[model samples]
Target chain A: MLTIHNLQKIYNGTTVVNLTELTITAGESVGLVGNNGAGKTTLFRMILDLIRPSKGEVLSKGTNVMQSGDWKNYTGSYLDEGFLIDYLTTEEYFKFIGDLHGLSGGDVVERLAPFTDLFNGEILNQRKYIRDYSKGNQKKIGIAAAALSNPELLILDEPFANLDPSSQIRLKNLLKKFREEKQMTMLISSHDLSHVIDVCERIVILEKGQVVQDMQTTENTLQELETYFTV
Target chain B: MLLTLLSHQWKAKLRSSIFQKSLVLNIILGLLILYFGSIFLLLGFGLHKILGNMYPGQDVVGIFNSALLFCFLIDLFFRFLMQELPVLAVQPYLHLPIAKNKLVHYVLVKSVPSIFNLFPLLVFVPFMYTSVMPAYGAAVAIVWVATLLLVTLLNNYLLMYFKRQMSTKPLYTLAFGVAIVGLMLLDYFGVLQLKAISETLFGAVLVNPWLAVVPLVLLAGTYLLNFYYLKAHTYPEELELRKTNTATGGDIAFLNRFGELGKLIELELKLIWRHKRTRSIAMMSVMFLFYGFLFYGKGKFMDGFGTLIFVGIILSGMPMFNYGQFLPGWQSGHFDGLLTQKNISPYQFYTAKYWMMVPVTVLAFILTLPYGFFGYKIILINAATLLYNVGVNVFVIFFFSVYNKERLDLSKGATFNWQGVGASKFVMMLPAMALPILIYLPFGLTGIPYAGIAALGGLGFLGIIFRKQLLQWSANRFVAHKYKLAAGYRQS
Candidate 1:
């Protein structure tokens, strides 16, 4: 349940993001596909209020994300390493996040039990600081921490990037499970077409900061998107 | 190949985002350097006159010769403090076809441009012209100047090696410190005369111009040692060994009681201890707590209440000034996490910082309580200044910190890294120093100085009383700038 209205982020006369209108309804899983400068990450940053939007506002569940702190309660985002505190160990970071969400230590332990396989035994019980973790492992830690709070709305940018093949598959399965069982709202942006098609119920393609195409997932949706992206 | 690498480095320096963003800051820094250069030039020109004034009827050249070694030793100490190893920037080139020798040579040559090497020449060259050239003739004077430059270079490379060794094993630093102090003490007592030894060695160089070869040899030796050391340890794992790793986990159970904010404070404490730059700065602040001994030991500043206030502020207020100046930049690494993932209100964050400074100020006061043994009045003055520092300077520093939008890389050493510095940092000094002086000056000028000191304490106490309101105000300020700060933090 997120809405972008007249949103524009301009940098020195260049429009970085200029979405006229975009909305993801409750319980919908959407995949954002774009070229490098398509403003996918910029849009996510505006939604999180990490950067100020130039013209309009982003609304989450009828609340202006900029004007209030209520949306952060149920919004989970992992756009980059900025989302993770690198100085802390994985467990410490999780515990701190859990405490922020008012989850007991026991609750955090139970919640993390499901990610043990996704973690591939290298993350949990590992005594290394997050800074020392490999980039792919760090990605896993960030993605896992984004969902650690059990937020109703999840946004992950390039979640499949930097991930090993097995972890990527595991992550796809996890997102599928969350989508079906919990009916969670997710907005995932990735360059990986197959994975996006595999998980998302709807697909939105962006070009030059504008939404060029929006469609519900159909049997030929993958073929249609691939053909569109073919130069 | 080396030329290409050097050109790349040149381009990197000119094209860096920091260089472009900090043009005004760099101009100010350049002006400051020019100012220091003028001072050293004045000192160089006036060397003979000053030495004659100090040691009347003595040979100024002999005096200068004796002092040369001492000056170079002090220069070495300062180089250890100020010089950064330039080799770290070569990481991107490691996979290229560049030879490791060329890279090491490039790093060593790059260090030559540092201000440290230029400084001694400014102070020494004019003296050599005015004093030695006339007396020794131009040829011998040239030899003497060449010798001095070579010795300076020798000290630079020697200390570079020592610093690199010390980084790998701190025991080398301890041993070096012990050796230096031992020599100083040996010279302080009549056991050994460093002045006499320096006089003999350098004075001999003046007499025999050929003796310049000795310093030349020493310089070459040190340069080769550093060259080979770099060659031997060019690999990433070997370089990683050079960094000292301490225990990562430290539990502060007391912090657990404060809930999420407490956890943040605990995390801040861990950040300070775990990082080299922060840990060293924090330790240096603590070391400065004993700095009162420098003035108080000599029985100076006894009645100068203004001086006492300065000491008190230096003792108690410096940690806040030094550490608080960075503020959220210190959290730049995880600032986005702080903003989006957590439900932390700006008010709670500011309050946590306020509480964190309280203990530091209190600890400072406790440490200075012994100064009260010097005089009950000294204790009273310190207590008042302590309160002023905690109450007023804390908030003032925090207020100024909001303007410091530049992000800091926490892992970088603090000595010369100017990542978070801007015009705001310079402006911050105005309130920190002038406000306290403004508050105290009127009382001293009036007949009753003690009352003025007490008035300062009263103001500080009022600040403490209304801290909640002040924190609320600070929190509101933080919230207003939150987006701008978050964007700045994300840049790096």
Candidate 2:
């Protein structure tokens, strides 16, 4: 569960993110939809405690994220390529993350099993550094590593942007399975409406760093979102 | 078109982050160039007289002629190590409507004004004015200077061609180095008459200016070689000196025993080994271990505590200073990943860096132990400085580490690189090097210098004892500054 209270981020007198209050309960999956410069990534960064908020605080389970680092223990996040160590081989990076989470080598391989389809056999055993991988492959590696620990809350930004259509659909299915089996709380931001609607039980449409709509997913939710975004 | 390209290159240099962000660094770089330039000019004017005195009865001109070949050879070796290939600058122009021939000419001609080509002229032109004009008439002197410049350009193009041809084969470079050394040794042992041959060849040019055509033709040949090579391989990846090979190094099995700390150290070592810039810094640190010889062998420095302590600090601490000045910045590429990782407390991160540097400092101290052969006193001072560096100076680096927010592009070579190097680095070095000497200065002035040396070591011993507290303090500072650092890195 995560909460934001009066969170505001401003640069050079221009507000990037301004939220009076927002909260996500346990077992809830929320998709953040926004266009470019909608402050989606900036809001995510504040929640992750990577960037200090200009006003108010982000709370992970009632503890201020900035005042404590305990949220990192149960929060799995992959916002961008910055989350991935590019110099390490895919296996090495996985092993490193697994080691941090006290996972055995076998546990690492087992957890990565779910990613096999999405990986398309191009990730592991490539014998090249992550930096040398194509953009799509690098995103896959970041996503898989973020999920390797099976953290309580998952945060990913633009998870389907660089991925091919096939991988994107596979990823959507993977997310659905994780939510169904483990009740993993997810906060995914994407420009893809249908894919986000398919995986998330709720949708929060954001504009200019403020939430415009927060509604439970329905059969007509996709049509409603498409109509809202028409202009 | 060429002018537009040149102006673009000029703008690139002027607007680069390293240049625009730090006026202090730019001034320091300018001063260094001026210092070296003045020194070369003075040597150029004074060389003929120095040679005349060394070989009293011999012709000064002949002596200069004899050394020309050796100078050129040494110059070539240095150029091989430091000269950057200008191939990548031509990449953006490749798909444009520009003529391929004009672009190739720009790449080849761009190398002519580099420090490797121009610095020698500082010496040669002055020597030509002072000595050659007096000995050989004005025409001959003019011809001789032209010949030298031709040979210099020839070496430039020759390196570009050979380096491109043998880019992937390091063995050829090694063989070339060995052959040069072998030639020098043969000349030293009198198995070859290089000096005589050099004298005759240059002496011939003095008599007949027309023979300058030899070097002229060779220069043209090498230029054409580089021209055709660039003409054929204008593709950016083909022109790249080192094609991205599969990652070579793997995890250090032994380091895994230390658990998370070991993982951090293993990652840092891999970073050093994999990147060109970090690898060169490592190599430079090794080279600097010989720094002790400069001070230790001199009797005046032997009698003094300040100079010897300075040398001791540099000898054992050069690696830490060179690498640590950019602490956390080296990890700036993946800093966000590091911050959000589970169970990687800032305390553990700093502790890992502390432990990693201690062993290297100890290793450097052991390697420089032979400096004790110079005198037991030398060993005493170095041992004290080593302790000081490990304890006090390491913390000094850690304290200043938070200010290093610039993101490093590790792929580039370290030579002439100023990326991630801010004015704070120069500021940080002042206290790290000078504080130890400051600690000793009072005792030396009081004429009880041994106590001063012991005090330096004693302070270091205290720091080592309280290292936990110091590391925790550093972590606290890092936590306070992490947002700023993250923002800076994200911008780039």
Candidate 3:
């Protein structure tokens, strides 16, 4: 479970994020929707502690994640390639991240075994470094490595942007399966409303640093969510 | 459109926080020195004497015209060698509505106004004016010089545009080396009769002043030619085309000699190789050989067996010994990975460095031997000195990193640092030379003649032979000062 209480972020002396009292429980899937500059990415980064919040706490269960009190050892994220080291091979990178999370190399290989040949094993011995990987392939690799951790909390920012439609659908299904199997909690942000609609159960609409609407997907179409987005 | 692109490029560079602060300070200091020093040096006593000796019978106008042409050509040579393609600004416009040819033209035109184009003209014009034009009218003098400036700008821009497109280090090296050799050969042959050329060229400054238009025509033709080449090959971001697919591990036959230490040395060498600018250090490794030649020859300016032996050690060991002076910064990006590895011993790292220097020093001594025309004793001393670098200097310098403050720009021109290299290694050399003398001096004077030299050579040989102990001990000291090392890595 994650809780963001009175979270605020300022940029160049102006408050860009000012959300108040948001929470999601374990196994819950949340779609964060906002127009450009509506602070979805900023909120995710503050939660991951990549950036410090201007005010208030990003809490996991009862502990403040921001104070360096406890890392969501359970959290895996790719806000951008900042989480990935490009010098590494896709396999080397996944193994290194797995090691960081205290998984053995064998354990990582076992988890990745099912999907290793999915990209025609073109990736495994491709000898192509991450920097040379196509934009979509890089996204796939980052997302795959994040999922490889079997994290309790997985957060992805703009996961569908560079992905081909098939990969996008495949990723949505995988997220669904992971949430069902491990009861994982996830926060995914995307500008493409349909990807969010197809995958996410509950939607939290943000506009100008405000959590303007929290609605069940069955109750409204994505178009109904836009009134909340208007500045 | 071209002006807008140029302005945008200028403003973008100016707005970059790092670029603005650093470049402004760098430019201001450079301009101040260039302006003041040129004036002072122009006023210095050597000018009239130097010009007079060089051009005995030639009138000043002939001298001035030739000098201007010569400087304009020099300016073009430099622009080819040193100019940077502003690749970043061109990227965004590539997919825009603008025609690629037009964009390329804008880039080529924009390059003409760079600071480098102005430098030679500044140095030549005023000095030539006062020195050369006393016999000519101001109208003829001013117009002739303006023609020179126009030609310099025109040709300089064109040559650079082509060279920038074909930029490769080895090509530059070969061309530059050949150019230098040609210039030297020309001087040595005394075939050009430069004094006459100087006199005629300056004299031509006065007679009708019409011939000065020739350099301008050459400039315009070359610029048009450059624009054609640039348009055909406008690979926008090619300027930033740093190769990332650097072949790791030893595929080369010579690298197999090093074993694992060889692999590491290979990796380090590859880093130097791939980054062409960084290899300036290795090339400079060759320059270090010249120090002995400066002091060692029998009829040379400063001949001494001891000085030659001393320079021998210096030429070989100084760079590697000096390298650790910027201890942490070289290891900056990989510090987290390197530090967390509890498996590899620090001595492994230290010894690998020694192995790298072994070949470095072998090359250094072999290069230094031509200077051994002084004696075979010098060759023997030089070999002993190479071994000495492997032993004593390598040990102390690794630990010298503990107090070192230089966080070298690993990304910058690797061979040179104008800010200043550290003094610890240099200070350490005083004792490296003198302490062995302490052991050698009393024994040589009182008992066996040349005993001091033998003892020093013996100690150097043994130190290299017993380098394991030296490496082991330094590793411990380094571990103890690990915090400082970490801090140093972050500094660069």
Against the true two-chain complex, what DockQ does each candidate achieve?
0.02, 0.01, 0.02
lDDT of 3 by residue, A1-231 (tens): 898899999876878899789999888989999888889988887786555577988888768864442444677777776555564577776765676567898898887765543343556767756756777787878777777778888889999898777777777777777778788888999987877877788898888889878888874667786555555
Q: Which order, best to worst by lDDT?
A: 2, 1, 3
Ten residues in a row with the worst lDDT in model 2 chain B?
A: B90-99
lDDT of each: 0.82, 0.87, 0.66
How well is each residue in B1-492 modelled by candidate 1, as lDDT tens digits? 556556656655665556667877899878999999999999999999999999999988899999877778778778877787675566544422234577789878877766887788997789989998898898998899888888888888888887888767789867876787787788889798889999999889889999999999999998999999887666443454334464778799999999988987888888887876787679778878888887774555785788878887787787888898888788888888887766688888888888888898898788778877777877887888888988888899879767877877777678777777877887887788777877888878987788888888898999999999999999899888888898888775
Per model, how much of the real contact set is kept? 0.00, 0.00, 0.00
Model 3, residue A55: C-alpha shift (Å): 53
Which ten residues in a row are the worst by lDDT in model 1 chain A?
Answer: A80-89
Q: Model 3 chain A, poorest ten-residue lDDT window?
A: A114-123
Docking class of 1: incorrect
Predicted candidate 2 versus true structure: per-residue lDDT over A86-190, tens digit per residue? 656789778867876788999999999999999999999999768668889989998998899898899999999999999999999999999999899999999
Q: Model 2 chain A — which ten-residue stretch has the worst lDDT?
A: A80-89
Interface RMSD for every prediction, one decimal? 20.3, 21.3, 19.5
Q: Write the per-residue lDDT of candidate 3 for residues B383-488, one digit (tens) a residue.
A: 6667666666666667676655434455445432433243454565566565544565576558663565566667778887778888888888878877776765
- Chain A of model 2, TM-score against the native? 0.99
Best of the candidates, TM-score: 2
